[model samples]
Target: MRIAIFTDTFLPQINGVARTIGRLADTLTRNNIPCVVITPETKFQGQRNYELLVSPGLSLPFYPECLLSIPNYTETFQKLNSFKPDLIHVATEFSMGICGLKYASTTGLPIVSSYHTNFPQYLSYYKVEIIAMLAWKYLRWFHNMCLKSYCPSKSTLKLLKQQGIKNLEIWGRGVDTELYNPAKFDFSFRKRFGQNKKLLLYVGRLAPEKDIDILMKSFQMLNKKHRNSHLVIVGDGPLRQKLEQSAPPNVTFTGYLHGDELSRAYASSDIFVFPSTTETYGNVVLEAMSSGLPVVAAFSGGVRENLVNRINGLACSPRNVMDMVTAMERLITDETLRKELSLQARDHAMTKSWDTIFNKLILSYQEIVCLHNKVTA
Candidate 1:
């Protein structure tokens, strides 16, 4: 089936939505299924396998590389009509997604929308708590238009349903075992950070909703206790300066790392600490698990789904600095427990691969098409 994905995030900007859409497009192309990516122009100026329809957009205060596209139904519908896609998959809830929904409604085409970001919970991070109710109302309206809405975790699916979102389903992410393996562990990488120190790593966008300030505070508490430990934060975002200024001397922020460098960073870390509660899936949690690293994440959202609370990794109360520090200290002091969790986490993660997730997505697409055709017939 020919599929068109409309999302605000794409290449030259590293994020989960971008990565997932790119990977799915590659998978579909490899399987002889045509796919098109509808996004704004990126720094890398060139057309990829799927045609890129550039739109008018600009950088925002929160997400820099990400552009907020101006909704142009005329141009979008014109191009989408030519693409002649069997289905349109809206990967984000931004302007591009809204445009796709409008076109699908006009043309009576089936659409599958992915509920990736949790904007309601994210509003508080930007100090816009008063608009929380308004955001939820807008979100409900946007999602209710889709033929089917896909979430990455069951927890998110349940939450969306509770908010009155219809036809919600779970579509989890996968990790590339070959890229994020236990074998990427390099002592040299750790040596560059701090020799003979336990490195606590957090890989994701360093933004407000990520609860980065609390993460820094939790690491500071741990630093006071264990002088031999260090904190390595990967990925960059709008809150980099505030985070860096408030962080302790033990923390090292790597702007961003990809490919082998990202793998090595994950492998060299002794334990992974994630404090964000707004994440829908926490893709880095899976990557950390595949890298054979024991994790300590918040108890809410997808972190609870990814971690088994001491079985695969440690769980701490969300936004609670004390709980996070205690969990970190416990893992640092207990070598046997850490090793056991790491081994189990890796084994569990190795079972879930991109190929498996991609097949499931394809099945969902086929099922949607079959149901639509039956109704039409």
Candidate 2:
């Protein structure tokens, strides 16, 4: 069946949403299912396998990296009408997503949506908590139009349900075990970054919403007692300069790394510490686990959905600096426990495959399309 994905974020952008959509498109194309991705125009000049349609976009004020697409309805309609998709998937609640919703509504196509980000919760970090009520209202209106509103985790599904969004379903994420594996570990990478020191990795955007300050503070506290541990901060964002200026000597910021470099970084690290409580689903957490690195993340949101305390990784109290520091220290000092968790993490990751996840998603799409056809017939 033909599918059309509408999203503000797409490949060439380094966020989780972009990567996930890119992977989904890849899977669809490989399985001989035709799909089209309609997104905002970006500076990227790379080749892609699937059909891509672009709309003029301006950089969002709050998030400069992402664009706010302003599509010409006439042009968009012509392109979508030619593709003739059986289903439309609105991956974001923005202008492009609105275009998808409008097209689906007008053409009587089966439409679905996925809730990826917690924008209302993020308002608190930006000091715009007053608009949170309005944000939720808009989100509810957007998702309520969809036949099925997919959430990345059960926690996220419950959250959307509480926000008055109907037809919520769990659409979990998966990691590529072959790409991010324990076998990718490089001693040279470890030596270059930490030089025999136990490396603690944090891979994601260094933004205020990620609670990076807590990570920095916790790492500082851990470093004071254990001099042999180092914190490697991968990925870059608005807070890079501020974080760099205030960071301790033990912390190393590696801007961003992709492909094998990213895999090596994960596999070589001793522990993965993600302080962010704002994840819809922690993609990096799964990658770290796939690489055999024990995770120490906040026990809230979608993070807690996968991380079991004292199982594959350690779960600490959200936003608690002392609790995070203690967890990091435990992993640092207790070599036996670290090794055991690493094994468990890898074992758990092996069970989650991208092919399996996408196959299930495609099946759901087929079912939705069939039901829509029957009703409209």
Candidate 3:
């Protein structure tokens, strides 16, 4: 079936939503499904064959680096409509998504959407407290118009239900087991950071909403007891310089590492600490688990949904440095417990393969398309 996937977030700027969509595009293309990815002109401008539909885009105010694409509705609508996609998927609730919705409305096409971010929760991070309610109102209205909204976890579905969005289904994210495996662990990678120290790793964008300060503080507390443990942070963001300056001596920032380097970083680490409360579903959490490292994440959002709290990994209270430190300490101090959890975590991750998830998503797409076609007939 011909499909068009529209998203505001894409490559050049790295995030879970971008990675997820990119993977889906690749998978769909490989399976002989004609697909087009409609996105903004990215900085890493190399022409690709996937029929990239670029639009005039501008940088966001608070998120200066990330582009907020001003959709060429007339052009995008014409191009996508001509492509004759049996199904359309809007991956973000931005201009591109709105354009996709408008086109779907006009063309009477079957369309689906995915909830990838918690925008309402992000307002307080940007200090836009006054506009948060209005943002929620708009967000709800935007998502409610979709044929069906796909959430990454049941936890997210429940959260959206509380906010009055119906027709939500769980469409979880998956990790590449071959790419992110325990065997990828290089002893030399750990040596480059510091030797004789048990490395505690955290990957993903270093930002306020991530509760990254709590990670640094917790590691500081963890150090007061376990002085030999080192904190290694991967990935960079707006808060990188400030976080680096404020962090304790034991902390090492590796900027941003992707592909093999990122996999090695994950595999090399003894434990993965994710303090982010803002994740709808933490992709790094899955990557860490697939890398065979036990995760210690906040008990908030989708992190709680996957983490079995001591079974797979520890789930501490959100933003609680002491609790996080204590939880990490529990994993660090108990080798047998860590090994058991790591095994369980990897096993769990194996079960949530992209093949399985994508198949289910395709089923949803077919269901929507068939229903829409029948109604029109």
Q: How do all models score by TM-score?
A: 0.95, 0.98, 0.96
Task: Score candidate 1 by lDDT.
Answer: 0.86
Extract clashing residue pairs from model 1: none
TM-score ranking of the models: 2, 3, 1
Candidate achieving higher lDDT, 1 or 2? 2
- lDDT top scorer: 2
Give the winner by TM-score: 2 or 3.
Answer: 2
Task: Identify the superior model by lDDT, candidate 1 or candidate 3.
Answer: 1
Cα error, residue 36 of model 1, in Å, equals 0.7
C-alpha positional error of residue 192 in candidate 2 after TM-score superposition, expressed in Å: 1.8
Backbone collision tally, model 2: 0
Ranking by lDDT: 2, 1, 3
lDDT of 3 by residue, 1-377 (tens): 78998888787678888788888887777777889988877664534446678887887766544567887787888888779888889898888888888878888888889999887887899888788888878878988998899999888999889888879999988889989999998999989867877889999887788888898888888888998888889988789999888888888999889889899999999999999998888989989999998999998888876788877899888889988989889988899999999999889888878998898888888788889889989
Residue pairs with colliding backbones in model 3 are none
- Lowest summed lDDT across 10 adjacent residues in model 2 is found at 41-50
Q: Which residue pairs overlap in candidate 2's backbone?
A: none
